[model samples]
Target: MTNTMWMRGVEWLAASAADPRACKWEWDHGEGIALLEAGRFWDVLSVPERLGLLTLDLLWRPALPVPGPTLVDLAAGRVGFFLPPDPDGGWVGAGLRYATRGSWVAVPPPYRPARSLEWLVPPDGTGTLHSPGTLEDALRQANGTLAVLAAPPRGPRES
Candidate 1:
């Protein structure tokens, strides 16, 4: 629907895919989805070091730190990890949104020193489905795993 971050993200993704060293994943941006044909994006989901990065600070931490390629959350309003769909079958940030700070804009990230999803959630129905841990702890763990992303490939760029 909205080109917003989705379009800009494609620019960064295009570069990362070409880099060969960058990890990539397939994302469904409503219109369609694409993959970077690079490394393993699932690396972020499986790694242990990534556990440390729960907040945006941790998300932006140097796991596979590619300052030039640019990284976008693609979920503009998403504060941390996954949250269940709202009653309307919609999510707070279910579309092509992204982190404003990282290598893009100047606005402060939504993540706190240690974020607290407990605080972020409204006291309404089905909020429990999205239960998460302490903000700081989650971000830390997530970032720990994300560190792998910061690394460049051992070999040179592929053709």
Candidate 2:
């Protein structure tokens, strides 16, 4: 995704922070996903100390060596975590780089947008953001990518 797309997500996050209805969360494993309930995101997600750290790092980390960004589905009540793209990317929950890739890192809590100082143009401008419409769509895309990641390396086949 381009900076503009990331910025749009950031804008949404900022707007959602104050809106009580705008509740979305992510945690370490399937158990965490199972434990979540509507209107209970803050309480459920904040319970585990480790998960709290992980969430903070994922959302705020500078460069997520991963090919794609971690996804949060507020409307669907799902959070999909992508393991870093490579080993040197850092441990999933141990430590994360919080300032490498983009401008999304500086977003502060309770997750409000930073006020604009001026209009800054990104190197790549005005491109369509590759966002999936629903939770199912996001899951499908994520799973497909995960499969490729999990596959054993192979040499190219002869034509």
Candidate 3:
């Protein structure tokens, strides 16, 4: 992405904060990341890194549209997917974490490299986010796939 586009993306992300100017200042000063509140413009669904990677692959199938911004914290072994806020808070899944309302998420500037935490898919400055239903489906499918892969091999039955 060009510098202008990258700046735009950063602006879009910082807009989630109470003070967008502060967020921009932090990035400009090399803080590397800014904490943005969740629930006003969007929420976050975080999952284990292994499962998240699989789900991301599934979401990126040739016929599917690209997913929204995602954050991966390698040291934390977690991945966070940005989603539209669900006032009803109806999302549920094993090992899934929903951050909304008063939650805060550490977000790195678009296209910038950060230690341990970084964006797997940076926002395109369009305010787009993943559909909760679609993300839930992908997560379920990815979880099932992991389970099957981890299952013990079946031996031949005795006669």
Candidate 4:
């Protein structure tokens, strides 16, 4: 199997942090409807993925330590995970770094667009972000990426 850029970085995380993608995700989770080739995805997950649900649980961190700047599908009844760039250059984290641009990224809960800062409300408020692993996994399970998952979260948090 071919190794994606991450695999090489996985071998040497300290060096990969300088990679530009790390910078992008460090600030923003991601956009929407992104495509993830298998090679890269596996590198981020640290598992062959053929391992199935076991891999899924680890990525979701159901029992493990979770990281920052994650992305997920918030569409009701169809939530899923996606691996954002490690935000740490893949040097010291446990989650995978998925390759994406400005798709598959839903505005986080209570997310407020720069222009709509005054109108922010529940789901529109930009806080309580999710794990990108869940976002990616949900899409793959959905059997399609073109299908954008729910609109971005609007407004502030309930708590």
Q: Rate the local accuracy (lDDT) of all candidates.
A: 0.28, 0.29, 0.87, 0.32
Which of 1 and 4 is ahead in lDDT?
A: 4
Best by TM-score: 3
Q: Write the per-residue lDDT of candidate 4 for residues 54-147, one digit (tens) a residue.
A: 3344445466344322223322212222333453334232233343332222232222222211111122112223354564454355333223
Off by over 4 Å in 1: 1-6, 16-31, 39-159
Candidate 2 residue lDDT tens string, 29-95: 1112211121211111111223322343433335332122233433333333322123232222322
Q: What is the lDDT of candidate 1?
A: 0.28
Where does candidate 2 stray beyond 4 Å?
1-133
**On a 0 to 100 scale, what is the lDDT of residue 141 in model 1?**
63
Clashes of 2: 7
Q: Candidate 4: worst 10 consecutive residues by lDDT?
A: 116-125
Q: What is the lDDT of residue 74 in candidate 1?
A: 25
Model 4 regions more than 4 Å off: 1-56, 59-64, 67-99, 102-104, 110-159
Q: How accurate is candidate 4 locally (lDDT)?
A: 0.32
lDDT for model 3 comes to 0.87
Candidate that scores best on lDDT: 3
Instruction: Output the better candidate (2/3) by lDDT.
Output: 3
User: How much RMSD separates candidate 4 from the native structure?
Assistant: 16.9
Estimate the Cα RMSD of every predicted model relative to the unseen true structure. 19.8, 16.2, 1.3, 16.9
